[model samples]
Target: MNDTPGWASPGSAPSDGQDATVPRPSEPADSGGASSKWSAAQPPAGQWSPPSGPDGTPAPAPGPAAGWGGPSHTGGPGHNGPHHGWGAPPAAKPGVIPLRPLGIGEILDGAVSTLRAHWRAVLSVTLVVAVVSQIGDILVQRYLLPAPVEVDPNASPSEALDQAADSAKASLVALAPSLAITLIGTLFTTAILTVVISRSVLGRPVTLSDAWREARPRLPQLLGLTLLLPLISVAITMVGIGPGLLIGSAGGVALTFLGGTAAVVVAIWLMIRFSLASPALMLERQGVIASMRRSAKLVHNAWWRVFGVQAITLLLTFLVSLVIGIPFGIIAMAVDGDGLGGLLSGSSPEFGWPYLIISGIGAVIASAITYPISAGVTALLYVDQRIRREALDLELARAAGVPGYGSDRPGHGPTGG
Candidate 1:
């Protein structure tokens, strides 16, 4: 008994004693924890009861709260998720052409798409412009030109020259007011149409009256911008050309050539830069000076792009006009036999109602197709600028009711897919 370990005794349990040798019910087994024991005692995974709360009611499984994801998170088809970059189009592929450095083809494609989408608006605006242009053309053709004076065949050469010069001066003076009116009307109309087309392309609401209202305020600025070219021409002519011609007549050919070339270059540059001024003036609601400035800014980095697009548009328009005009011209020539001479001779070409009607119809059709193209291009130019400056593509998509990316719904794709 004495040889036994001091920590053990006869009356006490062995070193591995569990409260006098019997395991205590309250103590957990070393090999089996409570959770493990419970799990083992419970049914297998398939046969187990659904998870329950402490109160014994089943707990809800995790899922999207509504048809889409939870309100806090974007989680649906077409919903650009949290990871999307700001001002970036979700649908836009990476490494494609950047929007900032837009190419001529992109601009033209945008313009064409706009026209295709909003043909009605484009047609309506074009019709109005065409009607006004045609009426103005007719007035100028019929009423602005002076009647040729009846000159005696026996009149002296000097007298004939004097009479012709005087007649020419008088005709120009008489046509001035009509010309001014026509220019003003055309500029105002074009400005309004440009605004309408721009708004339409942007998916903004616009009515004819609204377009007119929007354009009215900018008319003064537009008129100022429009007058700039003629004013500059007049100034250069008065100060440079007039003086140059006078001096050149006295043996200063260098001055004349230099002055003329400078004037031509300046005029061309100004015209090219301001070609998009009407659209800027309309869409931006800018003052004439400001609109001009804005146009200069927008065109600065992309002058060639603007120039190319405009040139292409002009060429296309010219080709279309030729296609239409050639047939009409041929018909007119056929009807007039030998053409202008025969028609003006005693043969007296009949101004038949049918001819007038056909010409009018042709004009309308041509206008319908071409007007939209021009308007749409201008609108697209405006859009391109906004896209460069303001990330307008995102705005446009939002306006088009595209989903996701901080829109009202969560978990929706950017394109509302």
Candidate 2:
């Protein structure tokens, strides 16, 4: 027998006072009155032990020690025993958030907490990725536009044809490398950023270098996940002449209504199912398939909650973008209406300094603000599920190096028994 503190052992009871070694009367009565029969029933400290069987073997041990303040009575406060200072009242089960519906405020608070704790990792990864993505955007735009055919009004038809051929050759040479760099940079940034955000939001410590390292191995998987949507879109387009006709038709009332509804439903489901995938990948170090499986399991019955939170986050991000984008768009329109129109119509203006600078700066600001919120909310939701399902609050407290049963802390419940 290990003789460790088995649950059945008559060990020192929980402390009622700071110094709880001192024994007190088992029952209360008048000061001078004879002790009650109940007082006599409790064995003295030194003699207390479980009743032995006829063969003198001790009774089997009770279950593992209950936590200091769990819902069940393990001879702790609010039970039929002397109250203790260390153990919470039976009513106070630590680490269990009440099973009330989560509100927007609670979700927001969790997000803020996540950002405050992991801002360094989050900001570093986000800024790096955003800059890379923006650079890629610039490169693709500047050098990748299809060459315009040169038309010489004074030249004969053959000479004009020769000029157009030369222009086409020049355009292909300029555009190919720029397009490749842009695609590669965007892919790398998305994978690494997803891992970084996932880990940071889950209350784990992750460095930017470490995130990049972890993400590298799973880059292919992330790329596959990224491309899955576009491939599906392409498939849908190929499925019917309806899609092509919808595009040409001015009012796609029936098609638009059906497609929009279907898109929203699928989007909601994907958001919920994959909400935990990034954290699973980063923290559990699983590949994309495994992480996705784990995420699907965790989110099985929690789809609505996930959908609500993600939808709200999207709304928030959209509003923030609109606030910044609307003004910048108006300014851009006012400054160079013709250039804006030309840009929209897929015509490149002569490459200029001012337009790029303003657009680039606005893009960066919008990305920075919106990226953290979206990432933070996902992380918070992951934490909230762990707390709800696996008693993760206590584990987190232990990780944070807080003592059990100390004063309550904000953003956390007490330790479970």
Candidate 3:
């Protein structure tokens, strides 16, 4: 489904083993597909073609699936191209994606495998972040936050509503500490894990120390970019409904609703547009604005594809979090319900410290596992976009020191690198 012209149709790949390396004559291009960064950057002579033999005959396409089209659609060495229905090759996985664009399943599986293979290092980073965040949250919930103030039963309805609003405001102010810490933690963890996942693609070991050292320099920019995104979204939302709020009438209310709906749609568009900025920043060593611009460029005309993949990854992580967190939530409710006086008063639903700690355990476990998956998917999406647009697989192979990729001669391989 990749749209590089002059590239052979991976769809028409042969079922036979040997000649699967040969690029069949070009078929009609898949115009509906997103144009790749690779194809856009390429010179006319640079698109991959069958290698000429020593005697000037065409040689086999070489060195695994060569195009960012991602594996082959027919049988070939180290590939099951024909059996795959989606034109996705099943080869070069289990933390394998750097050498090509990715299948959706491969991206998910690669994330899982990276976590599985480097559990110690990955867990160390995430455990520290998660624990710190959870502890801050518990402290805020307990000592700093007031128990919800009870509404006066005998008062007017308006008085009760005002009391409830005051209680909500106090709780939010108390929550500021935890939320602030969590935001910082997420930025650092994303930076470190992006390093770990990139190295993992090359089959390299990354210690927590190694990840930290590499990730440290870029932290400021990453933090800025991360914070900037939400600010931008909020600013747009406010600007959208600002005029309506000033009017204070029926027309204003209608205008506010319409403006808010439009704002939501714009916010979603911007979120998808900039989703790859983290990876571009971390892996490419790009500055905040540059990375965001890079992300926007890669995501051009591919918003839905990026959104779908991100949505699925998020759903998977959420389900996993629920699986671990639900039991702990139940236990916390059961144990803390009887002991807390607030239960009878109904001022707050937050359980005592016992509940906070217990439930926090589930939160810790879930965050530790899912953080890598989210980070990996984002990083891989950046890689996939590059493979599509910049022929990044060839460069990746060269970086990984893959055999034959170093030579650009006709006999060297399918990448023609």
Candidate 4:
């Protein structure tokens, strides 16, 4: 999917914050084909034993122990098979994910489950963001947008084409402020919701205040990161089109189209690769550049998986928005008649505040529901990547206060549930 090593992230530093005597394991527990993808590495009951010390004394219970299948992380004591196949203890549901690798459905379900469990916090963040974004869009549409140059129904073809071009130009210009608002609001909400989702994964209650306090300081960098991606994308796209413009021939035009398409493909790839940046930055407290680097790294081995989950999430949100917006759009059209058509077409036809307000209301409703889903999926994806790479599942388990796990270990905080 990538020409270079851009998709690869630096492996997390393997550390020992668990019991001193029982060494931390580097590899993960191996669950063979029998178990489900996201199933936990369930040793038989009482198999989680502490390792023996150098002098043969039993070590204390380990905290952030090794991943599944690691040498140090063999069954602790009174143990049988290291990886239980049949009748393995059921995966603990203390948090969103089992204490193991995550399946795609698990990630998506975790996002929705968090929303269901903590609707108050998720909806609160999204409500504010949606209002802000809808208001901006409405203002742009009503005030800043250029009046549509009404195309003469009987005009010559060239004249109508010119009018169409102008209308498109006006529409694009009008959409700028709305686009900016959406991006900024998404960054803000993503930050806060990442914290919410992180806490939710531990089955801990997270307040809006807690999310904001943890996320607020990273707002500026998040803003930078959000803006940078689009700007870089646009620049890359222009590079694709520039040569065609320079040549200004039919062949040049064809080249430009091909370049633009190629550019779009690359841009989407980059976006998916960096999709986990917000979660990484907000949770890891990293700077924008470092977070992006980390995201690219985490996305390395899992590009297709990430892309699939993101595409599914994107499809879901789009469907929800469309479902919510359609009835309101029809209502607006009925209420405002041809004026609604004229407004959309960039032509003036007694523009009414009622039409804009109704449409904006629909948008707000849709946005409020969709924002949390988008943010939650991205955050969970980041967590999933860390679990795969750094054995973050153990850390998360400890944070969630799962028994048999060490408490207050490094990289696991903000909850003791």
Q: Global lDDT for candidate 3? A: 0.71
Instruction: List candidate 1 stretches off by more than 4 Å.
Output: 1-101, 146-185, 204-207, 233-240, 248-258, 337-339, 342-365, 398-401, 405-417
Clashing pairs in 1: 74-411, 75-411, 76-411, 77-413, 78-412, 78-413, 78-414, 79-412, 79-413
lDDT for residue 66 in candidate 2, whole number 0-100:
54
List the global CA lDDT of all models. Answer: 0.54, 0.53, 0.71, 0.72
Better of 1 and 2 by TM-score: 1
> 309-393, model 3: which lDDT tens digit per residue?
9999999999999999999888877778753556667655556777888899999999999998998898887767655544445
TM-score against native, each model: 0.59, 0.55, 0.71, 0.76
lDDT (10s digit) by residue, model 1, range 1-417:
111001011122111122242112245565554445444566556776668988988988765434343112111112222323343333431111222325567556665655665556556666776676655655554555565555566767656655654675677676676667556655755776676555554355556666676667777777887888567665764565455556534344457667778877676677667776777666555667766766776566567767777888888877887788678766655554444455668653544444444455566567656666665676566556545433434434443443442352332222232
User: How many pairs of residues collide in model 4?
Assistant: 13
Regions of model 4 farther than 4 Å from truth: 1-86, 149-169, 340-351, 406-417
Error of 1 at 206 (Å): 4.5
> In model 4, how large is the Cα lDDT of residue 20?
38
Which 10 consecutive residues of model 3 have the lowest summed lDDT?
Answer: 1-10
Cα RMSDs of all predictions?
24.5, 16.1, 12.0, 11.1
Best by TM-score: 4
Rank order (by lDDT, best first): 4, 3, 1, 2
In order, how many clashes per candidate?
9, 2, 11, 13
